[model samples]
Target: MKKILVCGMSQNLGGVECFLMNYYRNINRNKVQFDFLCNSESCAFEEEIKHLGGKVYHVCARSKNIYQFYKDVNEFFSNHAKDYDGIWVNKCMLNNIEFIKYAKRYNIPKRIIHAHNSNNMENTIKGKLQGLLHYIHRRSIHKYATDFWACSRDAGSWAFPKEIMKGENFRIIHNAIDSEKFRYNVDTRELYRKRLGLTNSFVVGHVGRFQYQKNHEFLIDIFKSIYHKNSNAVLLLIGVGELEDKIKEKVHSLSLDNAVKFLGVRNDVAQLMQAMDVFVFPSLFEGLGIALIEAQVAGLPSFTSTNVVPQEAKITNLLHYINLNESAIAWADTIVDSQAIHRELYVQASMDYNIKSAASKLELHFSNICNK
Candidate 1:
């Protein structure tokens, strides 16, 4: 069997982590044994990976001694390179160029880098600076990488423009999922919602890190508007981050303490998706918005911003998008009113976002790559 190494910044079960997990689970393990190298020492998916027959390495260097840490990582990669057939950088978080150079020194073949974020110079000042630095690094590292995988077209266009590419070594491969978990059934949804204490009231849910990038503040404003127009509505926020306190304060100021519920980092996201009637993602930008797809699989109506990837989401009956500057009140009114009348649309959305089909596509990609 050929050894395979998957490297990423963290192994925590967020969007990227979850996507990697699903990929690892579905790949042809008999032909390719897998190893995960990540910064975080412990992750929620550690046990799951171990159970599925993979080795997990905690290689994050957080010490003040930068030179020593670099030397240590270089040595570690040098020693382990012989055991791996390919090194797949999950995203551009790892020392991709350095890894490729070291892998060459050790004669490791097939260095691949995956791009997962759509951020660019146009988004933020910090993004602009990073873009300049990334451009330089990409120029330096482009030759060492055998493949550069992008998660979405938007992510590809932002990270690897035509100027940096050699015609056709880059492509978009969506993060896959296990569709069986998100099967839409009213009985199952009702049971899950009842368990979560969500009564007959219409529920709007958002599942993502409570970070500035997610635009949680704007989501809160939209929720407030929804609550104002629809008295029997509730908002459920999943996941926790640095901005949890600020979000709570906003909810309190709006006097929505009773109407909104915050369920911290959850392991049962599939269940929560089933519990939700609708999913609202107001992120400023995204690589592929996996959570929206998850909600779609659960047959829940979704709403996102215009800047998100896979613009086809707007055409899906299960999702709607509004401009960033649009009135939250109007957006909320449209969502609530349409959902009330169009009940059958939810089932169609679930079928459209079928995880099984996505997973099959991923399996094909993994097989094709290994064959090449």
Candidate 2:
């Protein structure tokens, strides 16, 4: 069996974690096994990883102490340098190169750096310094990494220089999912709606972390507009983040306590997707917006901001990209005007964003490298 060390696993419930879980669940583990190297000792996926016959190794968080972080990296590579056939590192920003450097030092033949975000979401002074460090180290990334991967074209262009991106070493890997699991199910939708006491309500749903990038404040404003238009409308907000409390307070301040439902960090997101009449995502930016694709698979009409998401995210006609500068009322009007159209799931997405095909491609890539 070929063992590949995967890095950047975390406890966070986000798009990247969802993508990893999908890939891990679908991959042919008998031929290519995966072990994780994470900053946290425990993660939401750790139990599943162990159940799948993989091990998890912890390292010190780099942001807390840089010196100790490098020390841990060095020690990890020193002890397990030759144990793995390759190293796959998933990063949101292009700013961290310590693990790739260590992998290069240990002569790891296949060092893959996968980019998962189109822009750096951090804005503080420390964040700027880290961005600077990333810029300085980026010049040598091509030298150290054997392969470059990204979730979308925009993300690829964001992380790597144009010249490197044009090379054969670069690959655009879709943020794939099990589309069949999310296919439209009228029975399931009715069941969940009744369970949540939303049988008579027109539900507008948004699934993402309550971070600045998600533009939750704007989402609330849009919901308020929709509520004014139709009193039977209800907003369903999913996922939790640092801004959850603030967003909840905003909901309360708007006197929308009864109309807006906060369903934080749900495991049954696929089932919940059924309950929504329309899905709204007004992110400031994104790598590819995996949730949008999932919503499309679930046959929900989706509205996304054009400022951040690339055109490639539109798999079906149900998805509409609108400008963020539009008024909240305008956004609400558009959502209200568009009739919800049920779509067949897994057909188009299977051609591009299905986890089985994606995992097979990765398995083949690893097999080719092992043979070489």
Q: Which candidate leads in lDDT? A: 2
Best by TM-score: 2
Please write out the lDDT profile of model 1 over residues 46-136, one tens digit for every residue. Answer: 8878888998876545444567656766877877888887887766322235556666677767777787777651345755666677777
Candidate 2 lDDT, 1-372, residue by residue in tens = 788999878888788888888888999999999999988657768998999989989988888788888899899999997999999999888677888889989977789998887876766686688678777766778888888899898888778888879898898888888988998888998999999999999899999988777899999999999999899999999999888999999999999999999999999999999999999999988989999999988888899998689887888888898899999999999998765454444335756688889899988888886667
Off by over 4 Å in 2: 340-348
> What's each prediction's clash count?
0, 0
Q: Which residue pairs clash within candidate 1?
A: none
Could you tell me the C-alpha RMSD of candidate 2 in Å? 1.6
